[model samples]
Target: MSYELQAVIGAEAVLRKVAAQQPGAVVVPLRQGFALIPMTDELFDSATDGGRGDGLRFSKLPGGFERVLADWSTAGPLGYVEAGYAGGVGTQRAALWADGDLAIGPMFVDVNEPFPAIGSPISQVLAHLGATRRRRDPDEFVAVGLDRCRDTEAWLAVDRSVLPEVARSRR
Candidate 1:
């Protein structure tokens, strides 16, 4: 029942543009006009040669991510959002870029530690992207259907056969 994700959020057309430009990229539609490009392990590996961090890396983003996002900002704003949860403990992180500038956070929320405000980091970013909160939903994250799957890889429906075998905690 736990979930995890790392993705770039933007308008569907904008995300499609980025997906077309970047090999192996795919857009997962969300509520509203916004969609997300899930940063799957394969994509991450190809971008960073097995996800190496020795050369260069952004604090929250992977290496060279900002440059790619900046180059693709012509269409619209882009936001990077990541989240993970298991055993009732989790964390979420989010950041936004628009017009080639940082618009909002690189914000982080600790869900089970000291706890955070009602609106989580991912929800806040979605709100900034124009995702409205419905009356019944607890937050924008669930409203966007992000809770539909456990991870970005699932969102993309990635072919597990092509991925390297690794033990994942599904408990």
Candidate 2:
């Protein structure tokens, strides 16, 4: 089944703090982690227009970024740690920052574009493919130029930078 992630409870205060610090960003929760989506005119205008197919639940992409937190949520394991959206007709991309130490993703686009031609990595992380362990650097975080995790079109954009800070900030 295809699943979408949602926000978490009790994370509102921290999300608000992060939002205040981030200015144009809105905090969203993935089953695996959290996302920091930017508040742009294009984002607000494009989400509810049925650009994606039917049953595409955009409950996470609220019309307003500053709306009050609600208490309803789906009970399940989080699929992504965070996510980023690229709003457009041809490339309505959803870059999902998935959770777990070994997860690699964030580059889920509406259209399939060639890799290594669209993005740059935030940092590098250790990856395990079956029994092999190696370091996919710089571009690991960026999906376009990423070498590993090529099959899923997912990159490790958020592995190094955000996860640590999120952990520290929680405590």
Candidate 3:
């Protein structure tokens, strides 16, 4: 099915870096806008192996601001959240964020099936998170976090951080 998810950043939380790491933080642009770094390796592995915690839809590599930004820009705002799974056999879970706020479900979908259109539940989720079909610059928007939902209740929280270069670049 190969489902894809997208979200829009908020206005309050312009992407910024956390002082805890070097290079401060990095923002990777996508076709629609910029994105925070991909889920951590531990998180990705855990999700893929079906160990602990929710699973992720995408995986990211280590790199610098320019490279990530360039990749995101070219790749468009949309990227793989998770792949290599089907019918609960392989990895099928993915997490997407708008800023620091979780967007939708650990959106479970068959990577082998066609993605849902904008009016479907998945599409609505992406829309609620701010995703748009029109192209946008990451610097023009803010970032939000992603959350897992079942029925109407949210049960999980995914933290997101922005890149420091965003500020310098903006200046």
C-alpha local distance difference test of each model = 0.70, 0.29, 0.33
Task: Report the Cα lDDT for candidate 3.
Answer: 0.33
Cα error of candidate 2 at position 126, Å: 17
Q: Please provide, for model 3 over 21-89, each residue's C-alpha lDDT reduced to its tens digit, 9 standing for 90 to 100.
A: 223233333223334333444423322334332223333322222233233333232222433422334
Candidate 3 ranges with C-alpha deviation above 4 Å: 1-25, 40-51, 54-80, 84-92, 95-103, 119-126, 135-171
lDDT of 2: 0.29
State the RMSD for candidate 1. 7.9
- lDDT ranking from best to worst? 1, 3, 2
Can you give the lDDT of residue 81 in candidate 1? Answer: 84
Model 2, 1-171: lDDT tens digits are 221222211223344453453334454321212333333334444433433222223334444221212111121111212223334222222212222221343333443443344342122211211111125334323321222222221222335344443455345
